[model samples]
Target chain A: MSSWQIIQQSLPLFEKGFVLTLWLSFIGIIGSIIVGLICSLLKYFRVPILSKIAVIYVEVSRNTPLLVQLFFLYYAFPVLGFKLNAELCGIVGLIFLGGSYMAEGFSGGFDGVSKTQVETGKAIGLSQLQLARYVVFPQGLILSVPALAANMIFLIKETSIFTVIAIPEMTNTALDLIGMYYRSNEYLLMLVIGYALILIPLSLILTILEKRVRYGSFGN
Target chain B: MAHSGINVLFEGRNLIRLFGGLWTTVEIAGVALILGLLLGIVLGVLRTFPNRLLRLVLRLYLEFFRITPTVVLLFLFYYILPRQLGVNLPANQMAMLAFALWTSAEMSDIVRGALISVPKHQRESGMAIGLNRWQLYRYVLIPQAVSLELPATVNLVTRVIKTTSVLMLISVMDVINVGQQVVEANNQKFPTGVFWVYGMIFVMYFAIDYPLSWWAKRLDKKRLERANG
Candidate 1:
């Protein structure tokens, strides 16, 4: 088949896979954010044993390869009597991995907050929870938006690995089409474009946010 | 699970084989890092040049590598590139090419950031001291940029080491691949060896990466303190 005909025929499949990639990234990002917040807060508050556990978790996640983590979940989990479908395993693996990276981002954000601000919040009779929610979160969120944006893009790129376990994300869909059509070069180019479509806009937004952060729009 | 699997891993020459795999892993990472550093310096220097067309092309190259998944890149190199080009390269060569591509993009950013962080006044001062453009970069600019980029480059090396795990998927016969093969052969005799096998792989990675990461973080913290001034 001509390259034009191949692209026309493959566009719909690529769209389906592209949407699947976005959805998986959405779930992974949401799940990771919650996990990251909990872990970072644990460390921030120095919550006894949980803080140490959180540290170890972050270290382990950051140090190991995502592929090993995914493989561990996919192959080793069932051996340990926890059987999740490949998609769930991929998402969960991503959450744990992304969460660790995000926790570092969040902890950096928390560290960026001035101690005087915390003291001022306390002086104003704000409870610790109230202080954290109202005073600290806004500052930290502004500081962390760039990190979070970068991590989200990383997570989206990682979603391609789901293809290995048969998740039918963009990469896998393209792999399948390539096999079916025997147009390896064309389809691979298409795959790169498919990813760029999602990532380029995200990166542009990150640059803008980073600029805003540096300009002190949210206040230093 | 099975005690035999644990014993099997420790027994015979299996441990030696795993270590050999580690050697292979390190070799690949070292090669990629060196190649990437060279390529990154070229690309990074080109990025900072006054030529708009050159900058535009470099930006596209950086973005293409940066945004694509490493796994996808591996597939393209391993599966597609050779077939399309009508030339057959070995799997290890392809793996190295893919990794070098990824690392070059990362390293270029590091170089660019480090170069940008150097004050323009330093360049002016170098010129005032009768330094030519080359001397300005060599004597004044690159020295500072290299120091600033050291910690980040170390972190990048650790990352590349971790990423080598993915090479197993392409049958690169790295540590993970060798370990998997051993586990498969012993799986029938020792069905519960999955955790031990994979866990060991994780530990091996951690052993290599954790200390390096810690040192990088320390260096980065120190660099940040200096930069903050």
Candidate 2:
């Protein structure tokens, strides 16, 4: 069969997979950022016991792959009475991996704010809220923009690993097609196109965002 | 729903199988890293070619790699590319090729950055000493670039290691592949076998990752000290 013919035959299944990939990546990125924010804040504030827990969490998550974490959650947890759906497992796994990554970035951003600057704000009698509002937040956000962009792209690409657990995302869709119809080349081409459709725009938008954040900044 | 003991991880020949699988993962990543870095250095130097067409082709190669997920690349190489050419390679070799290609793209970019960062004056100095093009790169440019790029390169090593997990998706019998088989064999006896087995592999990955990351940090620290102190 012609490659075009194979792609044409696979369109409907591929569409379902493509949409799921987008949706999963979107939720995973957002959820990871939120989780990262909370965890980094805990460490930034030096919250008593939770900060220690946060450190361990970050280290563990940082050291492991998202694929294994998904396996642990989806396959292992069922034995322990937590039989969550595959999509749920994927999201949690993404957040687990991406959050620690972002926490590290966020904390690094938080740290990138100089200490003497904070002291200078204090000496000037800047209110606590005002100090954080005017000083820490903006700088942290600026410092964080590049890392956040990288993390977002990394998380999005990682959604492809969902094929193992049969999440029916783009990668899984291609795998299924190959299994059923043996059209490896055509369906694989479609899969790559499917991802390029998402990632190219994301990368461009991120570059623009980074430029905006970095523009007019005197010192990096 | 009972949580199985760690003994679930120790049952049968699971540990040996896992260790063997871990060895395969490292071998694949190691082959990719070594070959990729070697070729990447050549490509990096070539990346500065005066030819606009060559530069454009290189740029497209990088952009393609950057956007396409590695899994798709794996699929393309393993299931499609060689088949199209009517050549056959073992599954692991195909995995290695996919990873090496990805690593080369990344390392070439790094090498290009490092090479460019060596500054125009240094190249001028090399020419002032009557060094040929090959001699200049061989003695001065590459050595400096290697040192400058070491830490980032080491971090990339860790990435290559972690990414080998996807070898399982291709059914390459890597660490995760063994872990799955072990888990399946124990599914009847160890209800929580998934947790037990994967948790063990998690540690194994960390065991490999932790030291490399530490080494990278140390290199960064030494580089900083040499610059400042």
Candidate 3:
């Protein structure tokens, strides 16, 4: 079978898969950012034992492969109770994986905010919470935008691993089509092209977003 | 049950066997890393060539490699490539090829950044001294670029080490795969088996990557101090 024919036949399936991929990546990125921000704030506030636990979580999650983490979450989690659907398991796995990486990004961004900014906010008689809310957090967001975008791009590509647990994302769809048709050559080529179609635009969009964020003045 | 499983992992020769698996993982990572550094430097330089076509080709290569997941690439090389080429390769050799390609793309970006960061004045001075392009790169550019590149390169080593675990997916039986196998063989132990085995794998990775990360940080600190002082 010609690659073109295979793609023409598989286009709807690929579209559906692409939608799932985008959904997984978008949700995972947002979820992870929230998780990372919360953990980062906890560490930043020096919340006693919580900070130490956050440190351990970040270290272990960051050090290991996402595949193993996904496997543990998907396959092993059920054994210990707490059943989850494949998609949910994959998203949770991605959340843990992306969250750890983003913690570093958030922490770095938080650290980059000058001490004087906080002191200045204090001099204006803002409460501790108000100081961070009105002054520090915005600057940290701006500082972390580039790192956060890069992490999100990585998370999108890493979502391909969800195929392993049968999530019917782009890669999984390709694997299934291949299995059914046995058109290894055509299917593999379409798979690569399918990924490239999603990934290239995502990367370009991210680069543009990073540039805009860098150039835009956000009322500092 | 947990104690029995732990005994199996730690007993007479099992610890030694696990260490041997760890050694193989290191060997795979170390050899692939060295090869990748060399390939990356070359490709990085090629990408910056005065020739636009060369730059375009390199960009395409970089984009494809960068965007594709390493596991997919591994599957391609291991499963598809041999069938297409009508030649079979051992799984280990295919893993090496896939990783080398992936690392080359990553390292090339680092190399390009490091080289470009060199001051323009140095290049001008080299040209003024009648040094050819090759001589300029050798004497003037590379030495400085190496210093800038060292920290990123060390971080790349950590990436390569962590990525080596993917080889297990293709059945190469690296450290993680062995851990999985040991856990499976002691299935009745449930989560405890996985916990200890994966914990050991985690420690092994930490032992290697932690020092590399430390050295990279130390290098950055020293470089900053030098700039200030």
Candidate 4:
């Protein structure tokens, strides 16, 4: 089929798939950031046992394949009695996976906060909580924005794995459409374009954001 | 419920079959890493060029590969490429191609970062010694770059090994696929057999990835110590 013909046929389906893709990634990114921040804060505060467990969780999740993690969450959880639908499994698995990486990002950011800054905060009679909330947290967020943005982009791409468990995301939708039309060429090409559409703009925005943050007061 | 089927996964012959699958996984990752390093070096060098056009092209290539999910890329290559090109290749070859492409993008970034991290004065010193650009890079620049690049490169190798799991999607019969096959053969066991099978796969991945991670850490520490000294 001609490229235009393929575009005409696949555009509507691609739009729907794109929306689902956005939803999965958006939820995954927000969930991961919250989980990651909590874990990072726990580690930063030296929360003894919890910190140790958080370290293990971050290391294992970051090192392993996302596909394995997804499979473990999707297939093994039910065997262990926690039954989740494919969409829920995808989102939860992605959060767990993305959270680990984001934890590292936040930890790196936290580390970049100079020791003297925290010491100065303490000297000024600020409580530990006040120091973290006002001083360390703001600087850490700015310092870690680039890495966090990169990890979020990775999470967006990773939503494609939902197709394995049939979550009707972009790849799953594309597969079904291709199966119905028998036009693998058309749908797959459109799929690539669709992915680029999501990825390129996000990446460019991240780059610009990183540049701004770098040049902003964070550098000083 | 009582079990009726033979436990093939536990049998010696079936164990060998699974081992063969494990070997294939290693082979795919091993070859892809080597090819990826070569491509990564080339692209990395191109990325550092003074020419604007070369920089632009490399940037686009890097962004496309970086953002496009590996699963989507694998699907494109395995399913769509054959249809578009009207040619067929084995699943293993297709997996290698997709991985090599993906790994190259990642490795190039590592290479670029390492190269850029070298002090500019070192380049000036080489020029002051009357060395040409090629000679400067060959002797002074690349040696330091390689040292800095080693840890990141090792980390990339571990990534390739982990990423090979995606081959299960293409039906390459790797370790994960073997686990899936075992799960299918023993559905009556509910979750016990499947749990152990996946648990073993996780252990296998850890067994491979953890050591490389340690080695990368060791390299970083050594480099830091040498610099401090």
Candidate 5:
């Protein structure tokens, strides 16, 4: 079959998979941001036992591949009675993996706020929470934008692994088409374009945001 | 679920099988890293040239790999090579090819960064001493660049090792695949065997990779300290 013909036939299937990929990447990145912020704050504040757990969790997630973690969550968690569907497992796994990397980014940013800045905030009659909110967070966030951008891209790319656990994301859809098409390579091209479509624009936006963050446009 | 699948791990030669899988993972990643470093040196050096066209082309190559997921590349080569060129290679070779392609792009960027980071005066000094272009790179620029890029390269190696785990999808029989195999063989007797098998796989990866990451951080710190002084 001609490549264009195959694409025409495959577009519907690809669209279905693309929506799933978008959903997974969306939820995963948002959850990672929330989880990462909480963990980094805990570790930054030296939150006793919770800080230590956060540290270990970061180490474990950073070192292990997400594919294996997904396997653990999907195949094994049923035994523990926390059985999750494939899409849920994909979100949980991405957050589990992306959150630590994001935490590291956030922690780096927090540290980049400089000790002097923290002291200056303290000197202004600001409590720790107020200081964190008023002084440290903005500058730290500027420093972290690049790291957070990388983490976002990394997490998005990782959704490709969802196919392995049978979540039917973009890559999964392509793989299914390839299996049926008998050595045809057309769907593979679509899959790559599908990813570039998302990642390139996202990266461009993040670069703009990184620059905007420098000017204190936190709303972006 | 206390001690859920611990016994499933020690059952017979399962540990040995897991070890064998680890060996395969290491072997492929080792080969890819070495080949990637070599290829990257060539491309990276090319990227540093003053030619606009050359730099543009290299940038496109780098971004192509960067933007596309490596898992996609893995499947691309695995499928295309045999289908298009009739070059019929095995799964392991395809994994290595895909990984080497991806990491070489990463390494080349590191190389370009390291090369440019060498101060302009060093090049002038080499030129004043009547050193040719090749000799300047060989004698002065390379030595400094090597030390400058080492920490980043180590981190890249760590990334390659971790990312290579995706090979299980291509049926490369790496450690994770072996873990699944072990889990399958014993799943009936131990319903939670998948848990322990995969948990152990995670630990095995952490055990090897954490040290490398730590070493990279130390190297990075030392490099920063040297730069500060």
Candidate 6:
């Protein structure tokens, strides 16, 4: 069969895999943000041992490879009596890896908030939680917009690694097509372009958002 | 009962074997860093080329690599490039080429940012002092850019080290691949050696990367101090 015919036949398979990839990325983006925000808050408040644990978590996660993390969860964890399937492992690994970077971003954003603004919030009879929710979080979010966007993009690209562990994401789907149809050139070309189509727009949107955030001047 | 798998880490030659894998990781990362830095310098210069066409082409190259996942790029170089070009480049070399391409894009940004951030008066001073273009770059521009680039470049080195682990996908016998092999070999004897083997690999990478990141932070602090003072 010709390359075009092969792609046509494989379209449904690719679409299924593409949807899985999107779902994984979506969960990764939201889950990592939540994890990152909590860690950042703990570090920001210096909550004693929890703060230190957060520091270690961020450091170890940042320092090591995401692939190692995935392998540890998918392969090694069974040995430790806590087994997650390959897909869950991939999502968990992405969240853990992305959260470390995002935690740094969040903490940096919180730090960028003026000391006087925080003090005034306390002075105005606001509880710490209220201050964080109403005053600090919004400003921190604005300051962290660029980092958050970059982290999300990084997480999306990272979903590609799922292929290695037999999680049927887009990359795995493409690999399977190539193996089945012997259309290595066409399949690889299509995969690269497919990823570029999704990724390029995300990056471009990041660039535009960064510029807007810089000009918005809320953190200042 | 839960975490006993860690015991196999210190049992025999496993630790030593992991360290050997670490060495392979370093070799891949080291070769890629040097080549990528060289390629980056060229791309950086081209990024600010006087010719608009060259700049546009370089921008596309930069964007294409930046957006594509490193693993995909690795696959392309490993499988497709040799077939297309009719050359039989080995996987290790293709791995290096892939890394060079990816890292070059990042490094170019660092170089371009450092170069552009040089004060305009400094460039004027170089021209006023009658230095030619090459001399200006060599003496005036690079000296300043080096200071700005050093910390970021150090951070990039750590990132490259972490990224080299991906080469395991292509069956490159880097640290991760080696550790996986050892784990598979010991599968029958230890049965639960996966945690020990992979854990050891993690610690080895952490040992290498943590100090580098700490040192990068120090360089960043020093750079900030120099800028402020």
lDDT, candidate 2, at B111: 92
lDDT of each: 0.85, 0.86, 0.80, 0.83, 0.89, 0.84
- Can you give the lDDT of residue A120 in candidate 3? 85
RMSD of 4: 2.9
Looking at model 4, residue B114 earns an lDDT score of 83
Ten-residue region with minimum lDDT total, candidate 5 chain A: A211-220
Residue-wise lDDT of candidate 3 within A1-220, one digit each (tens)? 6678877898899889988988999999999999998889988888999999998888777777787677677655565577899999999999998998899889867766766687788998999789778777878777888788778878988888888788999888877887798777776777787778878887889788877777642433
lDDT of 3 by residue, B103-192 (tens): 888889888888888898988999999999889888998899899888888878877887787777678868877777777766664445
Which tens-of-lDDT digit does each residue in A124-153 have in candidate 5?
A: 899988998988887787888889998999
* Model 5, C-alpha of A203: deviation from truth (Å): 2.0
lDDT at residue B46 of model 5 (Cα atoms)? 91
The collision pairs in model 2 are: none
Ranking of predictions according to lDDT = 5, 2, 1, 6, 4, 3
- In terms of lDDT, the best-performing candidate is 5
Q: State the lDDT of candidate 4 residue by residue for B127-207, as single tens digits.
A: 999999679878988899999999889978987898788888889999889878877776765445666667667877878
Better of 2 and 4 by TM-score: 2
Q: lDDT, candidate 6, residue B20?
A: 81
Which CAPRI level is candidate 4? Answer: medium
Residue B114 error for model 4, in Å? 1.8
Indicate the residue-level lDDT of B10 in model 6: 68
Who wins the DockQ comparison? 6
